[model samples]
Target: MTQTVPTPAHLVRQRYRDPQPTEPAQWNEVLRVLHEHRSVRRYLADPVSDDTLRLLISAAQSAPTSSNLQVWSVVAVRDPRRKARLAALAGDQAHILQAPVLLVWTADFARLRQLADDHDAPLEGADYLESSYVGFIDAALAAQNAVVAAESLGLGTVYLGALRNHPENVAAELNLPAQVFAVFGLLVGHPDPAEDARVKPRLPQGAVLHHETYDLAVQRAHVAEYETRIAEFYAEQQLAHSWTERVLNRLGSVASLNGRHRLRASLENHGFRLK
Candidate 1:
């Protein structure tokens, strides 16, 4: 038996939107699947089976967690009515309702807190700002693994960050208890061929990848180059907008957040002291 190795350069280029591409030194199905990822907004009506969902969660759980805390959980919403309500709360993303399943990944400490309470144990550490970061990071890592797993199985998935726009409503809809925050939603289903969502380009490697130390002096030039490269990508899709302009507008004002500006308040209301 023999195994093929993927070219590091090709992977790097795909991630960086480099105009000059090189042939991969080696290749395999896994690497191919990984590099081929794109967020799928439009989905076909085909259903994702229970077996596949289980496989996705298995892969998610397999991801590394800090201190073996495993402080993440996923709520799979299959009911159409419930999914619709969630979609409404989550910035009205239509695909969330269209997809067969919307997996709401959460940063969960409630389970551990319950266990600690059962034994009259103190979980003061879980209340710290550092611990909150751990929970969110752990959840993100696990969800990204599930995204890859879904893509490997020929399933399309998109992360709905907009779910946080109405975090309180989302939490209420999902019946999440205290210490369990809905990190984001992942919509999984068959991709609709008509949507024609292409691979969106990213910033050049020079902009993000720093050697041993960081350098801010070179950032302006890299961003300028990226503006041109990603422009072509957007043009192909018949969309018009400068990458910098989009990013700036998306975060330029608190209003652009579409209610996510209240995230800190929402988190506090959800029982995260953030102290």
Candidate 2:
């Protein structure tokens, strides 16, 4: 039996779960990979080799940096013991231990600080709140590229934002130095086909793709529409949840942040002046 492979545009349209998907104006392997992204929660026990990890990092490094500072670093943790400990620290996400690799991406400024110290230079700029944004942005761009590359090679992945819940513990577990904060943990491994996680729906184009100026008045309407769409997705998984309710609960109170509400104090403790 022969199987037909989907084109890049088809994959892109599939991502949105678009009811009336249009043909893409452009197509490439990169687009194909980007569109096929789905956060896989279950994984096979297969290992991801060091050579492949190196390739993923190469792809990450190829991403553009803010002012070429490249204030980012990644720790590829394959040790099951270490991964299990990290998983425990990060909300006990089972996938972290199940996956062969947990790539801990960080917003690293320790290297630059050392360089400045060596040159007897004042690195006052790094203390500003803006610089923290730059580091976070740089790390995100790099991680996303790695995600795309992994998907292209038929790997599955999921982002563990819960790593921030107990930042201090995570930093200690990873042996991170001052000024190097774990942004997130990425679980990378072969997919468990039984999970069959489909592409999650997204807000419609009209909700985000503004013509020129931003419009806030119509946002409520768009969000309302998105709730209906995502509800169907949740129903298919036999889960009962509301998008609005979930979003509200996620951010309605500081207590819900799961220790992340103390991030400012945590950051200060870690040497990020964030002035």
Candidate 3:
């Protein structure tokens, strides 16, 4: 007997757990991979090969960069002791230690700065807040490309945003130079089947996909609808808190920033003038 394949409509339904989902106009392998994405926190002992890592980097490089400045770099860390220390700095996330490889993505400007200095050229623009944003955006785009490539290759991955919680320590551990800020870390490895991670549902299309003009007032209703829909997902994950509560707790106060409240100061200390 031939195995049945899932249609685009089915995948859409699965993505939102929507009571009524319309069939998409088109579908392909890329869409399937994107729709199936999930954060795999539990990983196996198996190593990610060098060949695969190179391919992932190449894929990342293929992502478009602003003015092709390519202001991003990635450090692949595999040392157990180093990973443990970095993990400790990043909220004690066990997955950092569990994964065989941790890729630290950085917004790098030191490379260009060195070139400018060598040529005796003024690099004043690098000190601006807009330039800093460009670097961060470039790093994010590159890392996301790598994430998609890793998932396509059957490797499990999870992004460690908490790496920024203690940016200075992470910078020291990675030996990052001034003007090279660690944006985040990504853990890549073989997933543990026991974990059985599921694809997280997202907000309804009406909540985000706006038309010619934005509508702020209708967002409350959409959020209310989303809360109801996502409640099922929360129950399945054994989580008691609602999405609103979780988000609020994350951003309710300065203390909730997990030391990131001083991010501006940290950036300044790291050579980002943010002018």
Runs in model 1 lying further than 4 Å from the true structure: 1-17
Q: Which regions of candidate 3 fall more than 4 Å away from where they truly are?
A: 1-5
lDDT of 3 at 85: 97
For all predictions, the C-alpha RMSD in Å is 3.5, 1.4, 1.3
Model 2 C-alpha lDDT versus the unseen true structure: 0.89
- Taking the tens digit of each residue's C-alpha lDDT, what string does model 2 give over 79-182? 98998888888888888889999999999999999999999999999999999989889999999999999999999999989999989998998899999998
Which candidate do you rate higher for TM-score, 2 or 3? 3
Cα-based lDDT for every prediction = 0.89, 0.89, 0.93
Summed backbone clashes in each candidate are 0, 0, 0
Estimate, for each residue in 1-275, the C-alpha lDDT of model 1 and write its tens digit.
Answer: 79665466666576566868877778777778878789999999999999999999999999999999999999999999999898888778889878999999999999999999999999999888998899899999999999999999888999998889899999999999998999989999999989887767777778889999999999999899988888888888877989888899898998999899898888889888888
lDDT of 2 at 210: 79
Tell me which of candidates 1 and 3 scores higher on TM-score.
3
What would the per-residue lDDT of candidate 3 be over residues 1-275, giving only the tens digit for each residue? 99888888888888898899899998899998888889999999999999999999999999989999999999999999999999999999999999999999999999999999999999999999999999999999999999999999999999998999999999999999999999999999999999989888898888898999999888898899889988998999999999999999999999988999888998999999999
Query: Runs in model 2 with CA error above 4 Å?
Result: 7-12
| Shift in Å, residue 245, candidate 2 | 1.4
